[model samples]
Target chain A: MPLSSSHRVSRRNLLKGAVALSALFAAPLIVSAPAAASAAAEQYVASIGKSILVVAGGSQGQMSGKFRNLMARHAAISAIGVFSLGKYRSKLPGSQKSEYYSLIEKFVAGLFVKYAPQFAGNRIEITGSKARSARDVIVSSKVHFASGKAPLEVQWRLLKAGSGFKIFDVRVLGVWLAIQQRTEFTSVIKRNKGDFGALLKFLRSK
Target chain B: MGVLFIDMVGMRDKGVTGLSRLLAAFCIVAATAIFIAPPSTLADGNRIVIQPVSDDGLDEIEEPGLDDPFEGVNRVIFALNDTVDQIVLRPVALVYRTVLPRPLRKGVANFLNHARTPVTLANDILQGDMKRAETTMVRFFLNTVAGFGGLRDIAGEAGWEYHSEDFGQTLATYGVPSGPYIVAPILGPSTPRHLVGRAVDILANPWTWILWDATTLESISPTLGETISARDDALETLDATREGSPDYYVTIKSLYRQNRESEVNNGAVLEEELPDIPDVR
Candidate 1:
């Protein structure tokens, strides 16, 4: 147990060497993590656009079941629904939470279905993306229609999930669809004395 | 200041004059706590990271959407406008685009922008946006001196991008309501607030003053050129929106309102606040 001075010096040196070696390997991984996240976010955003195009290609302005499912899978429907209710979130009929969520999903999908015919055969190009936080990335893109029209701008705000991302909000022409809905939904609720039924009817109209 | 930027934040750090400091303070106050544009729009040096996170974005959205109570009349006018566009405007713009090369057309856009600089500068100052005012001033100076009377955008090449500020956006900044959407025949989508703002802007413009008493066709030439340029640029985009929508009038009404909101939301820098951006660029 009583080591010589030379032996003690040799042990310390070996420990230091091991620490240095590990750092050399670990430093890059740590530094490049943000870059890796950015890349993933960019790819995810681009794929969403591509998948949309593929879904719309054969549908010809129709919302195929597949398109509805795709929207359901990516969108944070419950959160969006809850947020859109604003002050009336508590009044969203405890028995009808799922119904509210589904309606929100349908409302969103409806807009796409209505606009899909023009978008069919169109190309979606991912322009760039920047992180809002570790969990959020704003991915900017342009949709170029096959009819030789000028490109349409789209910005998607994605919230990072486990090994993937979920759609949070979208900005078109400087207005967020979710935010727009929130405005309308809250107003309708306010006008109807916080009637959840009225809100549902409004969504139905959309 | 309106619709996408936060600039001149570092001037104070660089020891600007006392008058500039006073003006900057006033501008910051006038901007009314607007968020800065996203950094991705420009080069690294031009990017300003605003770090303020405002309270729930919902607070801003609760305001009612623009009223379109005149649906019947607006639709009729919109139909007429569409007919006019298809018969004349589109053909004219197409011919104009064909007659002028890309460079020439761009030159026209640049010249128009430069010609409109006086009104833009005035709006920027009126909105108390010193940063935007400076940007307008520098851009006007550069283009006039080296851009051959703004037939070329030398300033744009120098990284001084062009952003137009108008009286409509200025009016919005001080909490003016956007009354109702209107289809003003040749002018297309507009609101009462915008109509008033346009009248003021025309009067505020130096060209209007110069051409007011003149007995020449020069006064309408810029208007014609602008119409053609805008139509040509938006030809395909408008067509797509039109074809896709069940109601082009309703779609345009929404787009116009949102675009106006976007314009008013761009302004003085706030650390950590997000700004609304226009789709134009």
Candidate 2:
């Protein structure tokens, strides 16, 4: 009976997971509908290069949560371009859990707070657009950080989800946050607790 | 490290297929040869010459053997491992991490942790070198039973005060030369020596009997649970942080090969500095 809550949630979660997976399987087709819509939006944003537009419905938490979940599973994180251990276990006798968590913690804590000036409330111009697929669009923009580091180039890859487009991935000047997660996390985790969980707790606490 | 490894053994794929097939044949031949290769053959260590297997340079693969059927098998094993963790083990780990009492968790950690060795803590104990024998016995016992428990903290601490036993380290101690790098199906990258060592380690596993003889469902219950819980705790950033190229598999294989080479060549030394361990009664 004590296991009931976890069991029940797990069952529901499994079903939800199934739905999510099916969505991924059917994604290319389901997303095509919004490709044209997103393309139109991209075209509109393209002309206004250097100008920022507030597009409603995209949640940073959703993306962050998904990204973190992937890391927790120790799955690969591909940001701009680097691969590091996203999990606690590695090829040696070290605290993989602590290492994984520490890096994730810093990135998670810095997520919106650090990135806010770039895109949160401000408007940046969409200088260029390259559509990789009906579902995959790479839109480039330049954002002046609060600390003002000369408007860095931000590449946004939006994926079609149902009737709307969701932010599938984000790369800052070819530097993807996802890929950087492993390298940064691995270094910090190895330093702090010899593992990955330390980073996770650090982030969650933030 | 990259240049050194390439110059020595060349890339892993240079002639791996041919080499593996040769090694596979060699295993059978060597086993047969053991009976016929003469008594002097077994006695002469000097007679064994380390011949370079192959040294072809890297090939720019047109399609690359990414879709090898063997690779698919390895992927399936990995996926199954993931599925077991996701479906059965993760929730349990979450509960364990969340609901477990601090003291009890600490007790578990102390009992399970073996990230370091007692010799490393020699000077801390007033008993000094006198406890070395006892320490060695205790260390061996703890590492063997609780190695897979994920609880290796001494005195409820989060990490182990010392290091734990692994196949790679064990092989190095035996003075077995690390043959060329290899990427095993499902197991990922290792060397010929370490690969053989891993298989031997698995065979020697004390829990193997419990796992194989026990009811399949019951046996997998704990492993799957632990794996999934570990996975969930890490699910958040698994993808976005990957720093590999488009050919992620090649990158992983190469990285594993390179890291193993470095670890072995550099010798298996603990990279972290741990404080002296207090005497354990």
Candidate 3:
């Protein structure tokens, strides 16, 4: 599903209170990009995640290499985040054997090239971000998609990472595509007698 | 603190207590009047209820006019509804349709057709049997998953079965008159009674039941997302159809009545009586 489809598929205020805490956690952050640029990058990555999930389900056609790169760029951030916050057991670490993770990497890398212009600008908007709990944060960003219509909603959840946070899950629309994929993967694996290789091949095949 | 607490206590005796007594007296009088009200008078008021029907035969009613004034409205609504459906839903359907890869779509549609026969059979088998309801419930769930979960493949193969029976139809089945036809903004062609029926079905759909079963945010997302997407698609079609007609209401009403009539009666089809397309070549 395209990230647009993710919005089609399915709140928070950390405010004056977070100013102190944000200052406390600020310096180690490697994001040299302005907050707006960083938000645009984040949105792109979330979109790529949605695209990979949609394509993996065998619901979409062979995307152009250009499109694939665009998807890869956006997806890379969270893929790395997943490995960084590596409590969850996933084949994402073994990208060589796991074609799923490999394709996902390509998907996000592709996205960065296509959305680089949007990222270059400092005018991106990130508004109404709030911490659901100490561990979970919901941030809603407004970014322009292809149509140049009103800004679309791209939201993500970041889980605690020692002092900072890592992207744990992102919801497009309301459906957590990652969770959905996981659920479907579990059922498919059980039904197929643990042959994830066959399932992956089938998913990746034309 | 002591002075404030004592002052609060003093005010409660004079104001809150007195108000509570007055409200209590009003409630007692209201309750007595309600109890004294005549059952016949209550029955005579405008209350809509589904009447029991014999299983042997369904009630028959006059067919809707093909050239009814509201035809324009019906067609417009359906067209707009179809537009939205095609735009939003077609993408999803196209994806699923590719995966299932028919001949399967037709095959699935056929399977559902045969499956429906048993619903009537069960109605007969149980002889208005509640036990049969259990079998029907099981069958309905299994088929719904197969039909909906596998929508494109199943529906494509099976052909569309507009099996939606609303409260209006239920009322009509039980000999209740269809009150004036009204066009709901996003809901499309509906009579006053059918509108009520739509409301009831919206609440009663299995999706809502599932939400009740698992009231987590996770469970709620997919169902709500799908519903809104589907509804948007349907409305999109209605909007397109409305744009085509000079008189939207006439076109929609005509189409709705014709569609409903066709549904009710297994009769010969009539040529569409609407005006020529203005823009399309």
Candidate 4:
């Protein structure tokens, strides 16, 4: 009745394969269908918009923690940090990787705190939503200002994170934040003769 | 009046006719191409379907890169254009933004948008986007009748947003290659295909015929107003972008590539390389 060593190894491999296949089949449950994702993305957008307005009005240092937590929970900062390097992704010096990530974290958090009031105070309206992929949803919204200035159009690109989703990138005023920075950082690196530290230096300057 | 008429007559000499008209049209477009440029995204937003163009899958669609083959000449023109923008356009736009009441500025933008509804409708029909064409017609009716000559965008308020459409995009839909980028004099970014498309849209504009200023053999253009409105609207964001950029030229080039590609695809999600971008509940 006892199996040989080879038979046991093959059995383990087959079980592992079955488990992996089942997980693959279950992947759709995260986002499920396009319609479901759209509704969930809309709700997520609404909640975030509400909180940002409530918490964003305070001083920079006062709101930094709240924003940091919000950002950490909601944004794909690591992915964005890597993406921001553009063609210079591999050129990132290993020793400075942690420093780069920390600096980028602060930079993004700082930007979040600064631009929140600009985009939030007027009025937040969920205009539309689209499924970029099964798990990636782009929810479009408008921050309409009471001042009659043009509304800020934001397309929040989200991917399924944990049980829900996280903000991957944002397109505001016809520019993607990550993409815009990609060009900037790459240019800095190039201007410095492909020294990755130059990018770090540039971010530090900012 | 007499001189313009004489010029018009002189323009008719054999093969030179098309060239002169093209020159005149090009001059007009160098003004209005601001309206057609890829970044002319004044829409509330558009929901476009992801339809397959060729037999190949969506993955086969190559990424549209910044094909700036004319980088050398483009930089020269872009520099010259930047200078003009700084010394002239930016200041004018700033003043326009500052002096004009918000309501009046809104009306100006709405009016300009309203004026182009017919042209958009025409392009929608040309591109065989019946669904979009239908929405265009509805928005036009609502904006013209209810919004009062399209000065309010009542249609947009009613959830029917007006998206920009043109022959350029139509040509793109049918798989035409838009040649190299050129920063047109005082007009910003363009390409050869776009130049041709602009000419067609210029002709498509009913005003090009309705309000023909025979003296100049050109359309009575609201393009100057359009340029100012666009500049005023984008003023703050552009200033920030310029200040932060190590190279504004490359920044703009990247933005243009993204903008044009997104517009051409009508904001459909065929998915990007990073398969699963996170989302929130």
Candidate 5:
């Protein structure tokens, strides 16, 4: 090892070249393997329907808890993005804004609990799925009520999150849920003279 | 009658013979010109014939924006309607849905739709659609005769389609612009043109005229029943929309505008081509 400096330098260069060549050959395989894995593991629109059925199966209080958990896991980003807090976004202090958002989540969860029971004992069949964009999918389903009434059409809008998809909105009978909430909330804010505090109070009260 | 028929036949022979002679002369002249054309000129004509036609002028023109001058006032009225729906209509519809059997509710809806046959027929005629008017008359007759006054839709079962038309659609077809979107109290969405159309339609409605001399309750019962049936049918959809929309007013406004536009265009617009107006919140 101590023989000649030139010999040692050439030997080090050879080792480095060998390592670089191996990395070049292995890089594409490493990248391709994960892409294939993710494609296989990607969540589908039907998964949201299955999750909703589970949440809808329970009692109101239990359903609320389950729905809240489901929302926390899937809808948190979409809720914040779509609710359109408007002036309240800047007017509300950070802590209060966070509180407002949390209250809204609970209120929405309560709404699901209130409505989901009506659909209990019903079969939710996923009919089809449509891709709205690279990141969004609309899953169509039919709710066959236990009373043998006409089936209701339901479409769940899902947004890609990480390797899976999360429900962002639901259209039942062609009416969108989030849009209605926005209208209601905006009306409340306007009535309260554009006071964020009042809006927060309203959410808290609910 | 015999003399008139003979005169009509004589007129037709004179007109047809004259038209045939004129067409024959035009064809002969055109053939002579084509045969006498030079080779270079003919090749140039062939080039023109083989050239691809430009479609720039034929592209679909985007529809103009709707008149919404009363948007502020309309929004207030919309809120009122929403409150009314939540407090009164929704609860009543929920009760109706829970209490009535599905088949009975369907029968009520069928009867209500059947009763409105005259309204649809009048609108069809006003829109100058004789085919649809005839279809409406036939459906009404068939349903009334075989379906026990439309408690059952026998014609519908037999594959005769039912269509709903209103004077508003007729007015639209006749170039009446929808003058300003307005959220009318009690009636919900309307425009000046539509409001006028509604008035005319109510006057023209045979059911209303028939029940005019009856008690107030008897006159209003059909309207009340239809409203309740429609609300009950839309319950899940309405509630779901309320739940899913970030700004209900904006979404609803857009949806209503799109619906009305489609109606006015006789559903010629492709769904994918519809603009998704974003919430203004």
Candidate 6:
């Protein structure tokens, strides 16, 4: 039953080769898990930046429609409304709240369309992104003007919702867009003596 | 003389002089030990020599008291600035915007920005940021040479980054507190620390020194041009803000504070944690 030296050496080599092959296959799976998760977050931020740049690239007349559709598809309009409403969210009925959100979303879309054309021909460069939490990521970008003006810093806050990500807010030159809107909305509500209907009427006029 | 020295040595060995010599030797050894001893061991060895003082008490006393305590005064100044803006700056800015073509205005702004590069470069050095200082110098050289007296913004076209640094930011880098918010007439929002920093900046500014040596009219014209051009540029945003906010003063104040803080922090803020201030009118 004593094996020849050549046969024994060949059998040992085969066993070693099998173990090495399995490690090679398993190494990537172990190493790539965390990396793949971070990559997904980065990809999500890049997509948001690309969408903004696309809207910014549109012609003056087409900007509003383009931005409105982009907002409808990619922005978390409901979450924004809730955040801006603050304590007032509890006071409004669910149906009225939904209506308010739609009106506000349309208003924002119109505003974006009006302003986006000004950035036409400008290059948007996505600088970097950082994960805020499991469900939130912040993307930083620079809007480089074609006229050789200084680039403006813009930050987008994206939140994970269901199977996709939605932009919850944006900050330009340190001023949070949603925060500014909330202040304005709250002021109007105060003037109307806490009447949400008056706020709705104001939004409608806009 | 040798016999006298021997006689003195014998006298010292038998009297107070010898005692004094022993004391001097002891003092020399003690001083050397004091100088050479490790500080930690010395503290334990000579408790009476080193007093035990707690820094915890000093920490509370020396903490910075630099927040917006003079809101009422600031609000009054802000109102004055607004009135001036309404009566003078706005109309002039409107005319400036409408009269000049967009490209022409951009050229003027670029030129003005180029002229101010030295100020930024100086502040960069004060902040101990040598990298930025080098960049600013390079930018200034490129713009002045290639952009034709900095009118064309050729440096920007070549992808040279523009940096705007002020003495206030330099002070912030050195851990100086903002020291209470104040809105100055014409100058708008500032803090006490910023006001002092501004004064230093004015002294450091090459333009100011140049103006000091130039004719009165020459001194006055550049400032006037800069003020008007800046106002013209900010016109759209300011008007939009005025129309968008019910309380315009509060909104501006809040925005100014937010902007300054962001500059101090170098624009680092967690997006998810960004305050949700609504933009709606």
lDDT of each: 0.63, 0.39, 0.38, 0.65, 0.59, 0.63
Q: DockQ for the candidate 5 complex?
A: 0.04
- The residue ranges of model 2 lying beyond 4 angstroms of the native Cα positions read A1-206, B1-152, B155-160, B175-183, B210-212, B229-246, B258-281
Docking class of 4: incorrect
For residues A1-206, write the lDDT of model 6, one tens digit per residue.
88888667586798898999999999988756444544565576666666777777766677767777878888888778866655454445677877888888877876675555454535667777666555666777777776656787788777767656778888876767776676667657757876778778878876
Give me the candidate number with maximum TM-score.
4
DockQ sort, best first: 4, 6, 1, 5, 2, 3
By the lDDT metric, which is better: model 2 or model 4? 4
* Candidate 5 iRMSD in angstroms: 14.5
* Candidate that scores best on lDDT: 4
Give the better candidate number (2 or 5) by lDDT.
Answer: 5
Worst 10 residues of 3 chain B by lDDT: B7-16
Tens digit of lDDT per residue, candidate 5, span B1-281?
11111111110000011223234334433433333323322221111111222233322222223345567887888888778778888888889989999889988978978987878888888888999898888889999999999998888667566667777678778775555555665556655555555555566666655675667577667666766777776676567656655456655654555456555554342325422322222
lDDT of 4 at A141: 88
* lDDT, candidate 4, A40-91, per-residue tens: 9999988887676667766667786787777777777767776676545666
Worst 10 residues of 5 chain A by lDDT: A34-43
TM-score for all models, in order of appearance: 0.56, 0.31, 0.28, 0.73, 0.56, 0.71
RMSD of candidate 1 to the truth, in angstroms, is 13.0
Q: Candidate 2, residues B1-281: lDDT per residue as tens digits?
A: 11112211211111111223235434533432232322322221112221222223221111101122234554455455445544544455557767866455544533322322332233123223344435544554555566444354322122222322334434554565444333343233444554554443333433444455566566554333423333333333222223222233433443444344333433222212111111111
Docking class of 1: incorrect
Q: What DockQ does each prediction reach against the true complex?
A: 0.10, 0.01, 0.01, 0.18, 0.04, 0.16
Q: Going through the candidates in order, what is the number of backbone clashes in each?
A: 7, 83, 62, 9, 17, 13
Tell me the docking grade of candidate 3: incorrect
Worst 10 residues of 6 chain A by lDDT: A33-42
Model 6 Cα displacement at B16 (Å)? Answer: 77
Off by over 4 Å in 6: A1-38, A41-65, A86-95, A186-202, B1-76, B270-281
Put down candidate 6 lDDT per residue, B1-281, tens digits, no spaces: 11111111110001011223234334433433333323332221211122223222221111111244556777788788788888888898789888999899988877877877877888888888898888888888998888888888777677777657777777777876555556655666655545555555555566665565566567656556666777776665666666655567556755665566566555678444354323322
